[model samples]
Target chain A: MKAEAFLQCSQCKKILFSVEFEQLLRVCPHCGHHHRLLAKQRITATFDPESFEELDKEISSLDPLEFPDYEEKLEAAQAKNGATDSVISGWAKLDGMKVSAAVADFSFMGGSMGSVAGEKITRTLERAADAHCPAIIFCASGGARMQEGLLSLMQMAKTTAAVQRCRENGVPYISVFTDPTMAGVLASYASIADIILAEPGALIGFAGARVSKQAGVSKAPSDFQTAEWVLQNGMIDKIVHRREMRTTLTNLVKMLSWRLVKHG
Target chain B: MAKTWKEWERPLIEVEENIEKLKQKAKASPEAEREDLLKRVAEFERRRDNYIEVMYSRLGPWEKVLVARADQRPYTLDYINSIFTNFTELEGDRRFGADHAIIGGPAYLDGEPVMVIGHQKGRNITERQYRNFAMAKPEGYRKAIRLMEMADRFGLPLISFVDTPAADPSVESESRGISEAIAASMLKMFELEVPSVSIVIGEGGSGGAIGIACASSVLMLEHAIYSVIPPEGCAAILWRMPDKGAQAATALKLTAAWAKEFGLIDEIVAEPKGGAHRDAIEAAGLAKEAIVRHLKLLKKKSGSKLKQERYEKFRKMGRFLSENPVDALAKTR
Candidate 1:
């Protein structure tokens, strides 16, 4: 018998052809659980074809404190992810709408916000604010990078300040929370937005489940930090499925940019 | 009063204890022995000072963390009682419930009207429970937001004291949108037109600290430590072992000196040799001096200018500049 490449869904454990699963955007057809996407895959999913023009491609971290094994890890992540940092952002056309989009990749150091990643996120907001374009961000992070210490912590303030400027410029800011958005990033820019959306089953909260459990603050049920729980908590506006994400965003862009979006 | 001492501070504590013991004996002994006891007491005092100077100057990163979280450390209420007058605390988020983890309201700082906010670590068990060990929930931050808005409306200079392990990490906190509350608090600080200063009196842990610590001038006391995560948390994540907290503390560079050198903080207010916990009166005085100085300097600027400067202050923080300011935001290819 000929060998066939197959994959098991992470959530549903259903076997399927690998190529078909990739074509379906890695979402399980049976259960509709959206798997985590890489930055490249996310860009392809969100932006128009050939519309992604990279920004700050040359910017990378300097290992400021000379933290042990950090430089090596950065190098390894760079080599594997083909990016300088955890976040990849730029001016792009999202569902035919002009926008500045920044996406965090959990593959790189758990998508932690170090100085470089922060600078990229800041520039994304700054650019959006200055251009009066909508800022759309896909946030996936383990909060601030411990390797960068206080510098990483300061990014929360920096990004929040950027968000302030973006809001003052009178443009909408949209945030999409992905899997495991917790701690510093959650406590800052990820939570404040014009419209907040999340993928199905994403673990989104300010503090970690284990940490909260250990701290004796949360005697939560099994579905505590899930997107449904976040929705129930009134933190997010909507939960969009993977296949319908582009359509939902298109409708939003059409409504928001009705005045500015040049009609053909 | 009973005191807790770290392992590294054993020798200094021993000498100090001896000074206390001999001083007791010197007060009641016969003339001859009293004189000798007095001389020995003086010698011990001198040695104690010497030990303090040397040991404190050479405090390891872990020791600083320990000191920053010392049981006797001056809590927010202590500083408020010592530094401000006619203080009236405004509590409750109004939207939900009250959180004693954070407390603030309009107060008289040096006889001038100013809004003061701080993380209140409890002095006793009851207070600690009341304060949630200074770990703020969403409502705590929301309360801060309300007070800050009032400060802007009333044209009061805002002063915030940062002292927290982190924001409360719990089911209830998350359910109430703790993340959004904190982010809103930070954004509110940036939006404030009034001159402001934030002083890190102790542990400025993670985003919880920065939620209110964004100001025109961010100051930290000499021994206070601020970081993205607590040392123990960092050790567990980075080294895969919680016992490697000492090593993680060293690597994190969370000291006030590091913050100053990195330009993340404006100044490092000097603490006494034994840290601010030893003499909270002096600590509050030093904090008052720094606050008055920064507020005076900031008050000269127009409200709009203060807001702009505050935005730039945080915007300019960090070691990463992939390109120059203009080029980084320049056109992307």
Candidate 2:
């Protein structure tokens, strides 16, 4: 079969129809594995009908390093993902409550954050603060884009600074970690929210598992870096299933926004 | 020689060894030529110094990376001992156990009370294992969060020294929420109502470096290298060839000069003639002056203003116009 013809669970190795997988929100029905999603898919799953307003769409990354074939790779990724970059962001309504959100699409260059990706995220939070509402970001990244070089690395500081500004303005920020959140994104914006939530079995950490294993002197435990492990270790606020993610976000936004208004 | 040095400095080392052999032969010659031979030996020493100086000046980006990671380079603790007084180290994140990879507590810098936090590396094998070679785990970052919170509460200035290759990337560190801990520390640092300065003393590698590096002013030593990923790692990932690390370093723009020119760092602290490893005490003295200067400037501003300025400082970096204007405009549609 062609790579995109039918879906097979990477974890369970169970083959399924493409339509069924889409209907299931890309979660495997057999093993309940949450597969990575595109930015548009995540937006569709999280926001109210016809309420998402995209922002900062004109911004795109520049090859400051002039990395070999970076332009070709970026163009191909854009064509495939139907977006300028890895992240899609805008103001949206969660359960009819207005909020701003940004979602990283793993399909787009492994959801790496380059200069444009970081700018979009920062602007989203700034807009959320301006609107005096809570902000939520769905993260599914392989960390900072290597092609952008130091420019990619600076995003960690840039995005985290934006999160700080949003919070300082009394706007609540929530981070949602999906499958395979790692590196600069995780260490900066994705992990620093007032409330952090994650999908079940998501791989979340600073370094990728294989890379870390090779760099480290000791072997890691079987469950290390998994969402369940992080939850048990008391880092994140909660672990929400794919079905419950929207509701959990809705309730959190409502409560936090209400607190902001009352306190301010 | 360290493994990295043997690999990179072999050719220079061979020249030095040959010079040493000539000097020994001269010393063993008859008494008549002893004085002349001694003079030649002295001349050789001067020439060697000049040669090293030239080599240092012409060092490629990868060579700079090696210098930054040199084992003889002084770690954070050495700086603290030389620059600060009356240090009282506090431990534990209070959520999990304490992490040895990071050290922080109240200290007196030039008789002024300040909170010092830094990544701690060891000089020996056992110590390196204990300190995880200065790579902090989750608990280490959490403890940093706690100390920063305390600094805010007491109105103490914060100073952090960065010298890790990267954050501890082991599975245990990830499982225990190293990412969250780092993020939390950054957020808390921004929220803190205290003057803060961070210096890259050596290898300021990636998220591990930035975790404690969110300060009002970020300074890097002349020889230090800061990047999103280490050059070797970046080469491995980008080219799928680890041996292309030197090329990757050139591409990464990780040197202090590049970082300063790009406005990524506020200032560059110049090292002694050789490097920090050549004279750590002098390096500490220079670091002290830089930190004190920034802290004094920052102390006059109100906490809110400092926070706002810091936020804006990072927000203003890495701006560029897209080359594909039509594509960019269409995406905006």
Candidate 3:
């Protein structure tokens, strides 16, 4: 019997065997850091046991830009990931606190943000607000979906406004930064979270660190743009291990629950 | 038996050497010149201390500018990490590819759960490449929108760190659609149903920075610069010369102090004695305290109330008392 193969680290160029990587949940054994997982797996891990109620799972994108072979590319990605669009939105529980979540699947066209992703995120936030539940988003993307043209970029403002409405409704919003969060996503709601978190060794920034090097800036220190660096810079609230996320979130929800009960 | 040179005839070096010799001789022959040498050394020490104190205390604005731009300055990420713990990163927009500009994740502050986001610059070449010099691209903004929406669903407060020159403007970026991404981010941030706070940790430039900066309360580091355009870009556009960046900086009111004075920023986090760079740990500590304090106050409100206040804050950004510039110019004509 042939063993399954695993993906390699895009940075250190280390190839991880399938079994070993899977045991670690795709996290690198050598690095002891988490790696990007499929959107489905992310949802499974983040939500309470058997608590995910998916929404808008059928929404997909069209080739509005008419870019050559764009449809074929989308089709290929969908076939590979078995998803209609790059984003998946749903209702779930984090530590028994009802919440809504939307995750972008990076395997689909490099996880670029497009019209569909924007709509899904907006709808998710709206649902969370309506339900009076907190919202949690797992962002993994390349940037604006180029095939969508200006429509993709417009999602920044549209989603930002959607979240604004959520804020007005007294809902809690949390953003989780992973490796390679950048560009338009950084400019928009990613940087506007009330509490932000990052994983160790994850590359995080708006511009590529190389751009600064090209601009004649000094070299980055070891760990620069890593989760530790962000934490030091006061951009994130904490650096929780992946395994501890559910428990940490539960504690937070419990506190919020107490406050709500007392006030309401 | 040696013939002694008079003090006026001796060179300064010779005089110092002779004084040292005399001091030695005083121990054996009771010489009178020893006291004078000690007095001169004491006077030099006093003068050196005075000069150093005076120079440091009277630094010029230009010099302060240099200090402000120092790369070693402690920023938002440092402070947030220190105060908050147990962070988990979530990556990618799942559409194009991963961008290394913007960072967001889940973390805990003072044992409270929250979500965080920020624009991070690099401390070195490799890191700068990873961070794209903190200039976000379309994906970065989109990712932020995704995160905010999640925060709303989870009832987690949001904290944003603004520190970027601007959005990327490469041909590839334009081809990829930059403006729409920014617009979407602005719209989503305005609608998020969580208490949000923004801190300008370094350079908050243009819509790229503002897209994620729509918060209930916005704060800035003392030396951080927040402006619609970088001084150099402003100079190139207004004066047709990049060398006039200093003038542009002054005119733009980009500094934290200026923004505070203009009511564009809610507060200014203080830096260390020489600047944040000189004492990053201390600087981060101070910023963390401020963030915690703000977050605590915000947690008191319901998600809906937080959203309302956040919307009102953005709505009031440019609502100062002033006549229309076009009308004033017409009247002058």
Return the TM-score for each candidate structure: 0.95, 0.90, 0.49
Model 3, range A1-264, lDDT digits (tens) per residue? 566586676656788888777756666767676878888887776678788888765556766435446679888998888987777888888766678888877788877777678767777877867777777787777666655543454455556776765676677777777666665565566656556666566665544555434442345566655667767765567887776666766676566546443554
lDDT of 1: 0.86
lDDT of 1 by residue, A155-221 (tens): 8899999999888887778889999787889888888888899999999977788887777544878
**Which has the higher lDDT value, candidate number 1 or candidate number 2?**
1
TM-score of chain B of each: 0.94, 0.89, 0.78
Top-DockQ structure, candidate number = 1
Predicted structure with the largest lDDT when compared to the true one? 1
lDDT of 3 at B171: 34
Error of 2 at A83 (Å): 0.5
Once fitted onto the true fold, the runs of candidate 2 whose alpha carbons sit more than 4 angstroms away are A1-17, A214-221, A259-264, B1-3, B6-32, B322-333
lDDT tens per residue, model 1, B56-112: 788778888888888788888899999999889999789999899999999998789
lDDT of each residue in B133-234, candidate 3, tens digit only: 887777887788788888888988888988887787543343344545675667766666688888877777666777788787888887677665556655
lDDT of 1 at B109: 85
Give the top-scoring candidate (TM-score).
1
Q: For residues B143-231, what per-residue lDDT tens digits would candidate 2 score against the true structure? A: 99999999999999999999898888876677677777787788887787799999999988888888899899999999999998887
List the candidates ranked by DockQ, beginning with the highest: 1, 2, 3
Model 3 residue A151 CA deviation (Å) reads 27
